[model samples]
Target chain A: MDTTQRTEQQRSADRRRRELLEAADRVVLRDGPQASMNAIAAEAGITKPILYRHFGDKGGLYAALAKRHTDALLASLRAALDAPAERRERVEATLDTYLAAIEARPQVYRFLMHPSDGAPGEQGFDVGKHSAPVLRRMGEELAQVIEERLDLGPGTQQLARVWGHGLVGMMHAAGDWWLGERPCSRAELVRSLADLLWGRLAAAGDKVGGPGF
Target chain B: MDTTQRTEQQRSADRRRRELLEAADRVVLRDGPQASMNAIAAEAGITKPILYRHFGDKGGLYAALAKRHTDALLASLRAALDAPAERRERVEATLDTYLAAIEARPQVYRFLMHPSDGAPGEQGFDVGKHSAPVLRRMGEELAQVIEERLDLGPGTQQLARVWGHGLVGMMHAAGDWWLGERPCSRAELVRSLADLLWGRLAAAGDKVGGPGF
Candidate 1:
C-alpha cells in the first residue's frame, strides 16, 4: 500500500462509484425507480458484493441516489435564482423550476421519499436521513438568497427560511397532485403558485413579521 | 335469490366489506403500508380468495384504502372549513386540521400517495382515481369560501381552486417533512402557512387577478 498504489486505488474507487451511480440512474430512468438492486448491478456489469461495498445496502444506494438528485435540484435552483430577474419574475422562475423538476423525475422522487415500507428489512430505512436534510439545506440556501433578493433586514433570515420551507412544501404538494391531472397550463400553474410567495413578501412591506401594521 | 334473503345478504356483505377494510388498516398500521395481502387476510380471519372477491385484487384493495383515507381527510377538512369562525381563524384552523391529519396517520397518507411500486401486480393501481376528485372538490369549496371570506369576484373561483390545491399540497409536503423532525410548534406551522394564503388574498384588494392594481 505505497502512496502511488493508494492514490491509484482511490482514483479507481471514485471512477467505480461514479460509474455505478450513472448505471443506477440509467436503470431508474428506463425501468422506473422500483428497479431492483439486481437490475442495477446487472446494468453496471458489476457483482452484488462490489455494489454493496460502495453503497452498503439498498438504503445506502437510495440515499446516494437521493443526494445526487437533491444536489442537482439545488444547483439548478441556485442558477435560476442567480439569474438577473425582478422579485416577481424570480419567484415564478424558482417555483416553476421546482415544479418541472418534480414533474420530470417523479418516479425517482417517489422512491426516495416513499420507499415501500412493507418490504422485509426495507422498513428500517430512515427517510429523514435523506429527505429532511434536503428541505433544511434548500431552505437555508433559499433564505440567504431570498434575503438578498428581497433586500430584507438581518432578522428576516428565519422568516425567509419559513417561507422557503413553506414554498418548497407547497410546490411539492401541488406538483404531486398536478402531475396526475394537469388541471392548469404550465404558465398558469407557475403564476398561481408564485402568487402566494410573492404576495406574502410584498404584503410584509419592509417588515419581518411581528405585531403587523 | 328471494328479496328478503338478498336484502339480508346485502347488509351482511356491506358489513364484511367494512370489516375487511378495518382489518387491512390495522395491518397497515401495525406492519407498515407494505403489509401484504396475506397479512391482511390473516388479520381478517379470511382467505385470499374471499378478499379478492370483495375487492378485485391487491390494486383494488389499495384504491379502496386510499379512497377511505382520502374521504376521511375530506370530511375532516370540510367540517373545519364549515365551522362558523372568522376568516383568519378559519384559515388557521383548516390548515391545522390538515397538518394534524397528516401527522396523525402519516403511514396511511404515505401509503395512499407513495404505495410500494415494486410489488408484483401492484403496479396497476390507479392513483389518480382517488386523489384528484378530492382536490377538485376542495378547490370548489375553497373558491366559494374565498369569495365570501376575501370578498373576491366570481372569476376568483379559479384563483381559489389554485389556492385550494396549492394550500393542500403545501400542507402535505410540509407535513410529510415535519412529521419526521417537527422543527416548529404545530401552532407556528399552521399560522405561517395560513399567512401566505391570507397575505395573497389581502394583496388582491378585491380584484380577480389580471394586473395593474
Candidate 2:
C-alpha cells in the first residue's frame, strides 16, 4: 500500500483495538477476573476467533486491559506524588489517590491485583503471574521517583528501591484488607497509613500493664 | 473395633500423612512450585492414586504444604516480635527473621507465596488464591499483636489493623525483591526497612538541585 493509505489503515486498526479493549473492560467490570473470552467477544459484537486474532488469547487481552488501567492509575498517582506540598500532605494525597481509585472501581482493582480473589475455575491464563507484575511495575516506578527526588545518603539508589517496593507492598496489603472489611473510612485509612510512614508506630507508648509490639 | 485400636489407627494415619508431606516437600524443593502429583508420589515411594487418597487433590496437597511452611515461618516471626527488646530492635529482628527464612529456602517460599513464579500449565490448583491467604493470616496475626501491645488511643484497634497489614506487606514485597536481586546484604535490607518504619522516609531531605520525594 502507498504511505498515506498505510497510515490511514494504521489509524483505523488502532481505533478498532481501542474499541475492543473497551469492550473487554466492560466484561471485566461485570464478570470480574473470571471474565471469559466468549463474553468479551459477544460484548464487542465480534466472533471468538476474531477476538483471538486481535489479542492472541485471554492472557494477551488481560495484559492489554491491565496496562490501560495501570497506566491511568499511575498517572493519577504521579500527579498526587508530584504536587507542590509538604512531604506529609503529598504522602497522604498519594495514599488517598490510590485508596480512592480502588474504592471506586474495586472490580478493576481486583482484576488487576487479585484476580484469584474471584471464584476460580475456567480461567486459562496464569492469573497470579500476571497480577504481580503490575505491583512490581508500580513498585519500580515509585522507586525511580524516590531515587530521583529523595536525598537518601550513601547508597541512595538501593535504599530508594527498597523503600519503593516496601511502600507499595504496604499500601497494597493494607488496601486489599480495607476493601474487604471496610473497617474504617477512607480518610482514616489514609491517615493511618501516612502515620505509619511518618513513624507513629515507633512513637506510640506501650499499653499499660502489657508488653509492647 | 475397640477404642484403643481405633486410636492407634488414627495415630498411624497421622504418621503416614506426615511422611507423605515430607516427601512432597522434598519434591517441591527440587521442582519449585510445579512439583507434580506424580513426582510427589514417586518421592514417597508410592503411586499417584495413593497420593490422591491422602491429600484429596492438588489443591488439598498445596494447602497442606502451605500451612506447614507458614506455621513454621510464623513461629519464628512471633519469636522475633515477642523478644524482649526495644521496638526498633524487634522490628529489625522480625524483618531479618523473614528475610533469612526466604533466603535460606527460596524455593519453599516461592512455592508457598509465588507458585506461579514457576512455569505454568502443569499446576492444577489455584496458586494465587492459596498463596494470598497465607499473607492475610500473617497480617491479621500481626494486627492483633499491635492492637494488644501499642497504646495508640481512641481508634487504636483499627489503626493497628491497617499498620499490621501494611507492615507485613512492606516486609514481603521488599524481601521478595531482595531475594530475587540480592541488591544488598540481608543486614542492610533489614536496616533500610527498619528505617522506613521509623519515619526515615519522612525525615529525609531533598536532593540538592532537585525536588523532594
Best by DockQ: 2
Tens-place lDDT per residue, model 2, A90-199, is 88999899999999988888888766545545253455567778888889989998998889889999999999999999999899889988998999999999999998
Two-chain DockQ for each candidate model: 0.17, 0.59
RMSD to the true structure for each prediction, in A, is: 8.0, 2.7
Residues A1-213, model 1: lDDT tens digits: 499999999999999899999998888667654567788899999778888899987668877887888888899998887766565676788878877887787776665544433222233234434555676677668767655544334435444556666677667656655775687777788876676555532232221331212
iRMSD, per candidate, in listed order: 11.8, 2.5
Q: Model 1, range B1-213, lDDT digits (tens) per residue?
A: 499999999999999999999999898777765578788999999889989999987767877887787778878887887687665676688888887887777777666654543333332233333444555566556656554444334445555566666776666656665665677788877766666666532232222342322
Name model 2 segments beyond 4 Å from true: A42-49, A122-124, A211-213, B36-53, B120-124, B211-213
Alpha-carbon lDDT, every model: 0.66, 0.86
DockQ of 2: 0.59
Among residues 3 or more apart in sequence or in different chains, the pairs in candidate 2 whose N, CA or C atoms overlap within 3 Å are none
User: How many backbone overlaps does candidate 2 show?
Assistant: 0
Best model per lDDT? 2
Residue A109, candidate 1: alpha-carbon lDDT = 64
